[model samples]
Target: MILKRLIFALLIIFSFTSCTSDDDASTPDRRSIEDLETDFQALNLQQGINDVTLENLNGSSWNFRVIIPESASSTERPLVLTLHGAAGGDVDAHKNTACYAEPGFAALDPIIVSPNGGTQLWNSAFNQDLVIGLMYLTQKYLNVDRDRTVVTGYSNGGNGSWFYAEIYPEIFTASIPMASSYSTFSSNGSVRTIETPLYVIHGENDELFPLAETQEWVAATRDAGTNVTLEVAPGLTHYESCNYSPYLQNAASWLQDEVWD
Candidate 1:
């Protein structure tokens, strides 16, 4: 009887293991980039917003937000790359706050590309690679005007705008940095080498990044012969400076009339 019981227990265990293996085999695998591309092709990409995930050569991935206006189907529109602050790891928040969010990047009528920073700061080799890859993808797939590409961001994102503008000035036409100062670049006049115009916006009463530092940096950059415009919002703080969708339209207009001139 004992021998019979042992054989029955072994049979039950083997049956359970086989069932588990079958279950594992039945589960579907994750979709590949090809699958995603196929899905994207089916969408009406000329209107509304799309949240995209793209894989890089290093097998890493990028999650970004793309805003395609109604004009994208017929017109080669300008592209604005908006970076995010230290708040989050994804582009969701930045997508909601960038020039493409609610007011519609209005008069600018540009395609907005906002990417996740992946880190708290923006000065990294991984981020640089990601930006280059993203730019390539945008140029190849989207109706992006390469000559009029703009880079803008707030806080930490603003720091990225300044850093990338200095490093890759050839790709960008102008930069709008809000409540940010030179992060990796110092006052050694290195920013003077930038050919792209800069519009520096800040709050007068910011406690995190004081307006005084920004003033000094802008003064130094200007002294270095870099074309720059400074706009200060009176009685505003570092946190308050992010309310920009309403005011950025004017800034975009200025870029069209002044900087791109």
Candidate 2:
């Protein structure tokens, strides 16, 4: 009888161990994409600058900044992703100071997102994927109005804006690229016909990116059934074109007319 009891106890122990092992194996290794997307929707974001890091689907991470206006609400608001020049600058320079101080844009009270492209031009496939992922996160978590999402950038960022708008035509409501022009990045049917109206802002006297290239690219995009408009600053240089507050306001107004109207 004692021997029989010992054997039965060993059998029970082995069965339990096997079942536990199987249960552990059945558990998921990672969160679903849908769940991950909405995971931060309830995040408590404060007004002003909030530096944060987000993980993209490909297991890569992005360090970006978000600027929330003081008058921000829980209701849906417009979201603008501003790309910096080749300088790899921070968000405070782009959002709180330059953009918020602008007239029309300040009144619009949109949430501004500026990403760190890490000292490189915004030309990487990883950056491209991160940008799209950032937009998805912002719209889902930050109360962004999906229909009013816009993109604008200066110099390198400007090139990024044009490139992204072409590749992901359905992602944005409008695109404004300052002191930049189209390149092989957006050419050769690499990007679909831009569904969003694109406003190309360049300095006629720009020495870095030639004005001739800007006009030619704009014309080609127009020929490809894209509703594009080019605005040239008469005497402004590439740097001045980005800092000219009035022109930034004008771009904001044009975006408002296109989507908010």
Quote each prediction's TM-score.
Answer: 0.77, 0.75
lDDT of 1: 0.69
Best by TM-score: 1
Query: Could you list the CA RMSD of all candidates, in the order they appear?
Result: 15.4, 14.0
Extract clashing residue pairs from model 1.
Answer: none
Tens digits of per-residue lDDT for model 1, 1-261: 322332343334334323434556566554443544454455445476788776543345667778888898899988888887774565465555443334535687888888887755775656665565566557657887777888888888888888878877766778888879674344663545456788888888889999888888887777777888888877878776446555566678777898765
Per-residue lDDT of candidate 2, residues 22-91 (tens digit):
5565665533355445544534678877777655443445677787876567667777888877754453
| lDDT, residue 195, candidate 1 | 69
lDDT values of the candidates?
0.69, 0.68
What lDDT score goes with residue 4 in model 2?
38
Q: Which ten residues in a row have the lowest lDDT in candidate 1?
A: 1-10
The alpha-carbon deviation from the true structure for residue 18 of candidate 1, after best TM-score superposition, in angstroms, is 40
Candidate 2: regions farther than 4 A off: 1-43, 55-60, 87-104, 184-192
